[model samples]
Target: MSESILSISDNSEVILHFDLKLSDGSAVDSTRVNKKPAKMVMGDGSLTKNFEDCLRGLGAGDKKTFEISANEAFGMPNPDNIYHIDRSKFAADTELSDGMIMGFSQPDGSELPGIIRAVAGQSVTVDFNHPLAGQDVIFDVEIIEVR
Candidate 1:
């Protein structure tokens, strides 16, 4: 009998190799670096609904590559998400660097990530949008084995 592709109800384990890249052909993440496989349940929310839809019927030893737009991938970046904060909030010894991801707590006791944009006297500009928010991404997937 031929191997069956993974389905929503399949409880078999699966190992997959994946590479995430930006529209500019820059590598964001890849499983090859650590030489390890990533496994996850089919119906779990670990992967986005759209991403999971693409893998609905792939069998073991199958390799597939696909691209997802900004909206489907990481969603469009919102300009309103950017904010400016007083420089004093940062400690004097703290070093400010562009493109650094920092976490800030909100009044609701939730923490949000922001990127350091710029720094001026007594003022710090930060962007809370995700780094890949506005960019399309490509996903390379290889299904090693599916139980």
Candidate 2:
């Protein structure tokens, strides 16, 4: 008797390594950075629907690279996500600059990161959009095992 391979489906546990890159070929994120592969169950809200869709029919040892549109990946940035906070809200001795990422506490007791856009006189412009929110990306995945 021959053994059948398991394909990825809803609730299937998947272990894989992936490289996320910008459309221009710049690296965004990779699971191999620390030699740790990502493990997750499909439809567990850990991955976007589009991303899971790409792996639906793949089984163990499958290698594939696919492109994901910005809308399907992180989605487009929303202007409402940007906010201007009074400089007084920060510490008196705090120094602010453009391109700095700072964590802000949310009402739910979680920290949300925002990027500094500008430090105008008495107001600080912060953008809360995901850094890669507006860009398309390429996903290179190597499926290690599926169960």
The superposed Cα distance between candidate 1 and the true structure at residue 57, in angstroms, equals 1.1
> Which candidate number has the best lDDT?
2
- Tell me, by TM-score, which candidate is best: 2
- Write one digit per residue (lDDT tens) for candidate 1, span 17-112: 899999788999998999998898866667777777776677777788889999998889898998888988988898988888888889999999
Residue 51 error for model 2, in Å? 1.3
| Candidate 2 lDDT score at position 5 | 92
In the range 1-147, model 2's lDDT, one tens digit per residue, is 988999999899999999999999999899999999999999999888999999998999999999999999989999999999999999999889999998999999999999999998999999999988999999999999999
Q: Which 10-residue window of candidate 2 scores lowest in summed lDDT?
A: 93-102
How much lDDT does candidate 2 score? Answer: 0.95
Each model's lDDT comes to: 0.83, 0.95
Task: State model 1's lDDT.
Answer: 0.83
